[model samples]
Target: MHRFYLPPDECLKDPPRLSERESHHALNVLRVRPRDRVVVLNGAGDELLCEVLNAERRALTLRIVQKNAIPPLPYQVTLVQAVARGKAMELIVQKATELGAHRIVPILSERTVAQVDAEAVPDKVEKWVASTVEALKQCGSAWLPRVEAPLTAQAFLARGDRFDLTFIASLQNEARHPREHFESFRSERERSPESVCVWVGPEGDFTPAEINAVRAAGALPITLGPLVLRSETAAIYSLSVINYELQSKRGQNGHLK
Candidate 1:
């Protein structure tokens, strides 16, 4: 089944009209016709199974056949990624979405090569938002992850209080292994934190002062392995580990049921 995302307001008690973008995709791209079944996500974890009632050049009306509330992930994982050069950030967002990241926040550190000015942040964020939408459609995800505006390292560290488990992937030998750090947090997993954010530095890594500041903000320094990965690779790898650990626990306890 083809999946598309629509606004919560577009979901009426009965059937509702599809948006212009969806309408175009359905009629022109997918070539969907009347009576064809389609799925629409409200971007808030609500999934609507609908059948096309009318297909026009500019609009496609759909009749809701079934509605399912897909609960959010038990443990929300946010990626605080340092800005990378070129399309690396785009690749990170796409793979991270498929791996179930709840949010992506771009951080600007002293070592960051690409800079998004105040005026360009909106445009950059818009691209990331679009990438998330396409990723959800490709990966069959029912919920959309948020893409936040770029922030400086100082500003990003200032928001540390929001997460119950915060970690930064570091290359320093002093950094503890990710598994050990994860185990420490897992001991308190029963409390089920509302969110967890992991920070990944740029190609050159965080400056000593920046790393110290993050540590002061309560983020534990964790190592991926002995080898160094690129900024985007490290972000995805960290998120993958988080999702695997949490999902494994859920499966073991039958919480997935």
Candidate 2:
């Protein structure tokens, strides 16, 4: 069945209406007709099995047949990605969402080349979120990842205490391997962390000062492997690894509580 995203407000008791853009896609592009069964996601863990009631150029109305709650991942993973030039950031958002990242925080590292103005942060976040929404629809995921406004390395570190596990990908030899670092945390905690956030630097990586700041804020330095990876690659790779590790653990435990 085809799936679409609708805001929560549009999902009340009354028949829900789709936005003009979605309406056009359903009416003109997909040629959906009345009584067609489809799924609509609210991006807040709710998925509605909806049937088309009306289709017009400016609006598409759906009647909810059933609603199901799609639980989020067992372990929440947030990617602190540095703002890379051009399409790299967009790719990061798309793949990271598919990899089950809970949130994406774009960072401004000392070595970052892309300059995002303060006024543009909202627009940038919206664009990344739109990319995430597209990925969710393609993958049939009900929960949508959030894309946060960009922050500087220092500012990001200042809020580091909120995460149960924090990792900063570094090329420095002194850093521990990511698997080993993650395993160490698993052994120590009674239960796996509910939230983990990994920081990926820009094309040139984080500056010495920025690294020190993050380290002092309790973020551990971890290495991906011997080969160097671009900012977007590192973000997706790290998220993939984290998702695999957590999902494997869940399988071993039989189910999540």
Candidate 3:
């Protein structure tokens, strides 16, 4: 079934209507006709199975046929990613959404290649939001990850937000495999973490001082094997491992495959 996105508030209308952008895709692009079955997502865990009532250019009307409320993931996963060059950031956002990341924070590290001026942060964030929406529709995900304004690594660290388990991909000798940390957490706590965050540095990786600062802020150094992955690859790999260990139910009983 074709999918469309509507915010929670708009999804509640007596006869829900797609936004202008979505409307164009439904009416002109997809040529959805009356009585066609489609799915609408509120991006807040609500999925409305609806039938098209009208497909006007300006307004596409849909009547709810069924509504499914998917519970959010047991644990929240936050991706603190350094902005990569070119379109890599967008690709990361899309894959992160597909992997069920709860939130994404784009950071500007000292070695980041894609430099964004202060005034351009909003525009960059907007593009990232669009990427998430497209990903949601394509992947049939019920929840959309919140995209945060890009911030410097230092300023972001200053926020002092903590998670149940935190990781930073690093090449330092002290870094250990992600599985080791999961095993240690399971051994000590006897349960999977309720929330997790993984930090992925830019092309050249975080400066030693920045790495030390993150470590001081309670982030464990995680090694992504012997090979160094790009920023986007590291982000996807981190989220995948986290989803496997935490959301995949394998760790519920203190064992993860």
Candidate 4:
């Protein structure tokens, strides 16, 4: 079924309508007409099975026929990623959303090459948010990851936000494979961490000083293997490993709890 995005605040409208951009895609691109059934996501776990009531050039009125609320994953994952150069950041945001990351914080590390001036942070964040929305619709995910404004790594660390399990992709000699950490945690705690976050460095990786600071903040160094991956590849790889190792055994339907 085709899916569209409607903000949470607007999802409960008497007759929910798609925004101009989505309306354009529905009416002009997809040629949706009245009575066509589609799914509309509020990005807050609600999936409305809607029937098109009216389709105009700049508006798509929908009559919701059924609404299903999907429970969020039992665990939350946050990706603290160093802003990659070019369009790589967008790809990271999209994949993070697909991988069930609850939040995405783009950081400017000492070695980061794609530096966003303070004035442009809002625009960059806006674009990343759009990418998440697109990914959500494409993947039919009910939850949308929050894309935060770009901030310096130091400033972000100073916030002192805590996660049950925190990892930093690193090349340090002491770095351990992610499976080891997952096994260690399971052995000690008898279950997966409820909240986890991973820090991925930029093109050249984090500086020595930055790595030391993150380590001091309690982030365990995780090795992605022998080969060095690009920043974009690292982000995807780190999230994939986390998804595989940290999730509890799946239910009979092959869905993670």
> Which numbered prediction scores highest in TM-score against the true structure?
4
Candidate 3 residue-wise lDDT at 247: 55
lDDT value, residue 189 of candidate 1: 58
Residues 140-196, candidate 4: write the lDDT tens digits: 999999888988889999999989899999988899998898778767876667789
Q: What is the TM-score (0 to 1) of candidate 1?
A: 0.90
| TM-scores, each model vs. reference | 0.90, 0.93, 0.95, 0.96
User: Best lDDT goes to which candidate?
Assistant: 4
List where candidate 2 sits over 4 angstroms from the true fold: 251-257
Which pairs clash inside model 3? none
Per-residue alpha-carbon lDDT of model 1 for 119-225, expressed as tens digits?
99888998888888888878878878889999888987666448877888998778886667656665655433446788899998989899899888888888898
lDDT of 2 by residue, 100-175 (tens): 8888888888788998999988888888888898888888888888888988987866664488788999888888
Q: How many clashes (backbone atoms < 3 Å, residues ≥3 apart in a chain or on different chains) does model 1 have?
A: 0
lDDT of 3 by residue, 46-110 (tens): 99999999888788999999999998877899999999988999999999999999999998888
TM-score-wise, the better of 1 and 2 is: 2
Error of 4 at 4 (Å): 0.3
Residue 10, candidate 1: alpha-carbon lDDT: 74
lDDT value, residue 136 of candidate 4: 99
lDDT of each: 0.82, 0.83, 0.90, 0.90
lDDT of 2 at 24: 87
